[model samples]
Target: MAAPETRWLAVNGAKCRVRTKGTGRPIGFLAGLDGALTWTPFLERLAGERQVIVASLPGFAGSNGHDRLDQHLDWLLATEELLRGAGLAGADLIGSSVGGALAADVAAVWPGLVRKLALIAPFGLYDEGEPTFDVFAVRPGTLQNHVCANPENFAQATAQPAGEDAMEWQVTQLRTNEAAARLLWPLGDTRLALRLPRLTTETLLVWGADDRVVPPSYAGRFQKLIKGKTTIATIAGAGHLAELDAPDAVAAAILEFLG
Candidate 1:
């Protein structure tokens, strides 16, 4: 039971901060679009089971970068370098939301870098002709309404006890949701969605059964598309962020799938 280590490293000159905890076969946990790793219970569960390395994507958390540094594809390269820096060659990868697309893209391009894959309610999967909700037009009440559908998990996430400023911070997460959208051409436009079928690693797709953001129907699409020995597991009463909805359930599902 080693203590978690926090350190910084640079990939292609982009500075990335990695939080590593526990010990065993290395596994990387990626954050979604809004970029925050506040899921202590979930991360602790994984850290206790394996050597966990949570990589902060550049410009999202504490990571910093400069102009001309394209983040989407660059993040894949950065991930490979980060794994190597941690003395890891191949690892189990789990990604949520925006992170899922990153994970899938990485698995497709560097097929040997990943041992298995888990995508939790990933974004960037919409078809070219499909319509998407504009993040900008999403009212706070609407966001909270959709998110709070899973009351138990939503409470766990917002945990906005009396004066914790949790609601304000959530507003921040909701507001900045467009940063990733601005970076990527559009969900599924980069061709990774089309290339999902090309991945050779065993894959696990987890979607919130009641997801409003990226409808559960997309889970069927992922099941039908990815070429790997992929398995899709749906978490009930969860919205887009299944981790926040039911971290324990999501973590358990991941443990079963990855193990």
Candidate 2:
């Protein structure tokens, strides 16, 4: 696969990093707490038919500070600005984990901005019976265990170099976690249920059967909230990061939905 071209854009007075691949109708992808680095395989698959734009959230990867975005609504506005700045205002949108929640909010608030929506284990709702794991509290080595069902994918995603490189990676992860916590800590709910009804685009909700971070049951909740055309799929033997745990399945589902 060809390497994705990375570029920087100024969105809402913050520098945002965007990786573009292939060329065709635009598909904007929002990365999760771990960023878009691990989704290269998934993006590569989608790029074959459409232009794929992966944007890192503020404070992750090459993006600027996240502190300016104090609330989930701010993040939604920033995302809107980013997509418009990148000429993807009406692109098909896909997001995972926290990114999913952001994508949903953007689609709801600005229904025309997203032509179609796909969310995988998105974090935006809280279920009392199936509480989300407190990822911020988990110890370093143990956190990976809750991320994905496949051990091989988990290992590859969390692998790090030794010495200074390891330290830098740790810092980057910490910052990313901090940014995610701003929207998902304590309770992962952003009251997205209220806004979900406003989404007019066709929506796809994918969940991992073994997702511990956001619980698989939330998939039903999402289905109930979305007022538009919706479909749900569960990837067996997968966890929170369904795209990483079952990349081909997730990619196929996304392409099928977009088509």
Candidate 3:
């Protein structure tokens, strides 16, 4: 496949890097914790069938301005602008982890913009009875184990570039973590349950049966709260970052839903 065309655009006052590849009906993808520094095999597979647009959120992948968003409303508005700026209006949307929560918010508040939604281990709900894993507490050396079903997936995802690029890569990871922590620290819930009932878009919740970050059990809660058509697809032997652990399976599930 050809390399994704890349560009920089201003989103909610932050400079964001946007990458686009393939050619067909467009699909917008909001990345999770890592900020989509590079497109993975899973995204490449999706691109084979349709246009895939991935954007690096503020403070991730060298993008800046995450500190500007201090409240949930700030995030919501920023996400909406990203979709519109990327020419993803009315397109099928996919979000993972924190991105999933934002996508759910957009689907609820601006249903007309997202034709369909898919969330992979999305963060937005906190069930004390079934406490989610504390990502912030995990040491840097062990973060991979907590987020990936296969620790090697995490290693690959976080592979340090060689030579001069390595230092920049490390700084980028730190920025990404800080950005994610700003939204997910303490508990990841943003009172999303109250707004989920307002979401009318068809939704698919994809969970990794082995997810430790947001436990697969949380899928049930999402299904219950989303008022529109919603279903769950559990990928066995996958964890929080299932797309990295089981790219083909994740891609297949998303493609089926998009179809």
The TM-score leader among the candidates is: 3
TM-scores of the candidates are 0.81, 0.93, 0.96
lDDT of 2 by residue, 161-207 (tens): 34437677777777777888877767888899889988888999999
Candidate 3 has what TM-score? 0.96
lDDT of each: 0.69, 0.83, 0.87
Residue pairs whose backbone atoms clash in candidate 2: none
Error of 3 at 118 (Å): 0.4
Question: On a 0 to 1 TM-score scale, where does candidate 1 land against the true structure?
Answer: 0.81
Worst lDDT run of 10 residues, candidate 3, spans: 157-166
Better of 1 and 3 by lDDT: 3
> If both were scored by TM-score, which would come out higher, candidate 1 or candidate 3?
3
Q: Residues 88-184, candidate 3, lDDT per residue (tens digit)? A: 9999999999889889998899979999999999999999999988888877588888888899887876777445387788888889889888877
Show where candidate 2 strays beyond 4 Å. Answer: 158-166
| Best-fitting candidate, scored by lDDT | 3
RMSD to native, candidate 1 = 3.9
Q: What does candidate 1's lDDT look like per residue over 1-259, in tens digits?
A: 3446888888668677688888788888777644643445667788878988877665555465523346556656765676666554588988887778777777877778789989987766675444444434555545544543464554454344355476666544543354455445444344566678788889899987877766777777777878889889998877777877767888899989988
Worst 10 residues of 2 by lDDT: 155-164
